[model samples]
Target: MSLRTALVAHVVSSSFYLARARILLSPAGDNWLRGRQRHFEQGGVPMRRAFAASVALLSLALFTLVIVASSAQARSERTQATTITLSGWSAGKDEDDLLQSVVNTFNSTHSTIHVDYSVINGDYSTAMTARFAAHNPPDVFYVDSSVAPSWIKQGVLQPLNTYIKKSKYDTTKFYPGLLSAFKVGKTIYGFPKDWSPLATEINSAMFAKAGISTPPRTWAQLTADAKKLASSGAVPGGKPICLPPDWARMLAFVFQNKGSLASVQSPAVTAAVNYYVGLLKQGLAATPTQLGVGWPGEALGKEKAAIIFEGNWLLPYMKSTFPTVHYGVAPMVKGKVNGNLGFTVSYSLAKDSKNKQAAWTLLSWLTGKKGMTLWMSKGLALPSRSDVKAIGGRKPFLAAGPFAHGWGFPNFSTTITVMNNDLQAVINGSMTTAQMLADVSKSLKG
Candidate 1:
């Protein structure tokens, strides 16, 4: 019998209490109970004895009813298998093979709870928000670090701190500074999965043709080097480096300038903006249209531009599309400060999920050792956990993945527009450095 069934038996055996009481209350029962009763003593039972016997019988029946109900309650709470749904942005054809492998592994081992996964199109932000508004959100979904703050403000994400503490793996096991992107107040909203650093993808052939032997290590060095390469007439395009002073690239310069996006009062932002504009004026970088480059990856493949600052994702595309192009990866040079932007995404649970425990099971499997290793094997972004770096080291392609000082890009949610537009203006020569930063600072107040 099951433990539940055994417990029911114990409850039924407890009826012995009522049986013993009934026997003691009866005159015959009392005589039988006496240790030393005179032989052949026979007497009729008293009215009180008869009344006590009737009462004892009634009590015993009531007691049995209670035990039956208790046993029934226990059976209702038994463990049962559950089904959970997961949502993410791994819908692209390129990501299909890796994502499907992860889902299959989880489904095989977690027979009690199967994960029903769906990959939404485009960005997860747009798709997830719409689903939540419709009141039919998935149990779990992808949460990019860049957009986590918006979700937190909407009160949509759940905190995983308590769960993390109970986990065998500690938070410190992953890279520091990156986790805060998913935090609001004292609660952590998401689990960081993978990250890539900002780096320059150089065409070695282009560099050699330009009579350049070294990649620049600082902003000044980059400008000077690009100038030298330009004068050599060896660069395929008219310009040597294809730097776009767009909002994304501008944020990196702002970070490297020791400027906080949300600082109380600091002028470092202006300095960074000025530097970016200066580079544009000096012709170190070009706008997309000017270079006739539709995509950075395609541009690099066609050798339209010699050098471009991009993240780790570009590596695979370059290898597959431009297999013959001799290329090498170099770290992001120091601006006024040492910093780089991290292209990162995380897995987060819904605040109102019906199956919280089952949902966590899927999350635990995906972000844990097994899930991380499977994803890393595809040679995509680097894993957040330190131990997983060994897998990256096994392949030459992954070793050259984007990272500087072994750190990925930093998240700066504050002054996003200012960082975006201000730097673009400066680079495009539409605004001065001071004007761009001041405009950005004012924009932050809105």
Candidate 2:
């Protein structure tokens, strides 16, 4: 029987037993029983039968109280909700606020689960790794595609196949490219929360001042426009573009040229590198550090550069922080192929989490169609699911989704770190493009 039914039966039984005992011990009942005992002595009733009935009634009363108390304790446990912790890194105030709002909604809506959301402001992977090592990891946390392989190898993430099956979550709604990043063999470790593909951002005022009417459509056009903007002094210090010297940023060009970073000697790779080096040589492009800025977004916001290649996250940043800067976004410049790089982070449940079911509930809600739509409605990130429509001026970002490639390289974090450290030499002319590629390839192999 159901616990509720069992509890109701126990309560009724206890009340019945207590009533019987009270009647037996009452003054009127005692007088009547004594009269019966007197009659029994006269051979009308049995005295031994009366005494045995009193003993049995008293024992049942005490046993019924114990059972009632045990039933009450069990019912309390069954009604209580489970609470789980969620952890993630925040890029800025806007991103944090949006995440907290969604989390609030989930906590309020779920009757059986409570989520405590925490933001780790510093290095995300390092902080999360420490938590895992100490056996105090959050029940659910964000995992970047770049570092997923290593985490999977270490078996720190729980395989989500069973939860997905039991919940009947429609995994097919998500972009396959992003979803595959969290998979090892046939097991999925997480569900992608959101994704952002690199797109070209151009300052409209700068473009108009340089006599350019529209954003560039090809690599050659981009280079020509940069040169024109630089010569016309439309950008600060006559630098037309700010490109971060990182492989993550440069990979778009490699992929556009139909090249793989794994094969540095291929003609396509050589062509892609040569194109970037040529722009640097012409003084039309500068890295963010060279312009005394921390990132491409800042350089564009401050008018240090007329154009930049950045992610969709820049839209919210620009709206809130750089409100006066009029700009337009377009898909990344094309080459032999249409290519743009997509970066994504997923919600993963910890393998050792004590509240696994509760954690899964939060994960499912956060990455589900309704929750994801709410989170991406602000346009801080693009929705990973196909069914979620872009709201709040996210058309440009959504337009780039078709041809965007995810960060799927094996050991992606280490490879990007090595490239970021070594590629600066090539940009500054200390090393040739070929040499830089060779060095990066060798380091990755090692």
Candidate 3:
């Protein structure tokens, strides 16, 4: 600083101290500093002492300024760390713990981006709906195939094409069917972290007792096997097959019959539904609920069912919950083609997120090959990325990823409820299959 400016600053500092201590400097807001000699001569203290003190105080003030500037920069840097909020629903405690560990790993390895994660264990859709309603949803969250369409329609999810292109992220690494689940037209909204396709879980002992050495490869064979198991009377508490009255399961059948959602009222769709309900009607297959089980997995664990169609998630559940339940995994029975519903979730970005870049960093890392491999190693779900190999007996689930039908429909929550209710009604003899087809066709159209 200039000499005059330094002297003026010194006077201001000295004057503050003097006011506090009830003392006085040449007081005129440093006006007397311009006439330093006259002020020193008239103000009655030794001029040398005053000049020396002012110079010392001026140097101190400059030092303090440097410290303040450096401290401010440090504060700025600390505040620059981007915080991303992530949310999802866990399949079980093990899956929850696994995901939390992955999140912890990400946070530790990343310096610029930090993630705050939460698991919405109960009704994840409702919780996330509330967040989006308030325009304060988490930066990234699990967007399941069933909800992707509706969320995209609501404009809560941002398109990731720009971020992907800028980051040069390898989208091609993901299974095309799984990745396309979150894509609306050509614009990709998110990347699948991992995926699972419906696969048959057959109780080998039950099949063996029924004298069936091979798992069914086609719907006809499945029917024959179910019949043999039902008539054999060797099956335990469960029936030949334990199926759920879920629209998701219905979609699997619909796809297997070569019936797309585009042809909801087609003959193929009707035939698929008939065949599924036929097994139930003939007492060969029973809904898990009818067998006094919470879900198909529960039925499988309790040995209540000889077979169940579930995702690779069943493998982990079987290992932890029912270790003695010997089973083999096979692709879902084929109809006109090999059809399985791909149950997948993507790490989707929120449209209202202020930290888009940081959120993308976390989302991409979780979906990237390395991060996915770390997660897939736990063997809870099959890797969505083609480059990431399946661990344990995950190959059956992984093999279906490329050709699996990534099924989803508009107004999915409502549509699923309707479809499931209708299917169950038909199963319980409250409605005819024709009636269900007509009602669902109307709903699907409307």
Candidate 4:
């Protein structure tokens, strides 16, 4: 164990050190500490002097204690909190701010564990993979459900089963489906922090203007509604729906048709892909890029699309960036049955971490009720734990929770890159749906 003493800055910067400082700064303790210092100086023994300076240094930095503190009034041993590094990709400035604030609270309240939060820029999975290969990864990092399979296979994650059992952590609180997504066999790898199930978001004003009263309930009705909205020109220079060529989004339709990534060449998958791309082909749907926006959420907010399919993460963005945009969320339109894609992420521990127990302290708190409630209650994303209770118009997303399927591929990054290209190719008419399915099926085999 490395004990690097802390230099506390705030009056109550770190409770462990601050408690001692409070005593040392008092009139009676001040005189006592001073007397001990002179005795150590005259004797040429710097223990007392170092002790005094340690109290002073405690006022400056939040680190480990360097010396043993002794006084006639009390005798106690103190040390700095274990520094645990945590990294994840940022969703936006607002989300980053909220997470930072939460981490600050964790640091102050936790005397033995301090979490250092950093956003890994660019591709999250790619950067994390490199760090793991270098044997210098953060103590804890986000494990997106889409990449969990590959990460689990690589053995870079510290299994959470022992920690959970030892702590008697209640695993049943989280939604079973979400929790299962982070598991391999019976070994628990991580705890889901939050989840979002795909749903349809409709522009209220546009739907009314198109003479449609409600969001579409099925694929057929969605197409019919889009045609009416297009003919009415309600969106003006934009299409009736915004559909991104993402496997995560498309997988919802596949599941609805009783298909899965298990067999990309299945008849169910074929029908699902064709139906999804046909909208783009018929000019009733447009990608966010076509509408000059960054994401489907932005396209909806900018009124570039009458409808869009997204998860609950869009709620906070809409609230902050486009509060005035009148919209309604509904379950994703069905094919043969109800299905939706669930996106979840967990705070997983690194196998190479020097501070596994300390990292668990931070990780557990992050996914625990207190930390999760403070973060997820803001409508930032749907809470994975059922008791946390979603806020503000979240029923539609919750409705799809039962039939929602988690997304991940064999070789996550490479598979997604191939899937994304083939999906876009079919959408843009460069490739046929049949060719796309065959290629995707081939990639799955490889």
* Best-fitting candidate, scored by lDDT: 4
User: For each candidate, C-alpha RMSD in Å?
Assistant: 10.6, 8.4, 8.1, 10.7
lDDT (Cα, tens digit) per residue for candidate 1, span 187-298: 8887777777667767788788877787777888888788877777756564676767566665667677887667623678767766766665777666666788775566
Residue 446 accuracy (lDDT) in model 2: 48
lDDT string for model 4 (156-249, tens) is 9999999999999998887777777788888988988888898899999999999999999998899999999999989997999998988878
The residue pairs found clashing in candidate 1 are 247-420, 341-409, 342-409, 342-410
What is the Cα-based TM-score of model 2?
0.79
Regarding TM-score, does 1 or 2 come out ahead? Answer: 2
For candidate 3, give the lDDT of residue 191.
89
Error of 2 at 413 (Å): 4.6
lDDT of 3 by residue, 86-108 (tens): 98897777788888899999988
Ranking by TM-score: 3, 2, 4, 1
Residue 195 lDDT, candidate 3, scale 0-100 = 77
How far residue 197's Cα lies from its native spot in candidate 3, in Å, is 1.3
Question: At residue 387, what lDDT does model 1 achieve?
Answer: 62
lDDT of 2 at 168: 90
Give the Å error, residue 419, model 2. 0.7
Q: What lDDT tens digits, residue by residue, belong to model 2 across residues 95-190? A: 888889998999778877878888987998889889889988999999988888889988899999999999898899888778878997779999
Each prediction's TM-score versus the true structure: 0.75, 0.79, 0.80, 0.77
- Candidate 3, residue 162: CA error in Å? 1.4
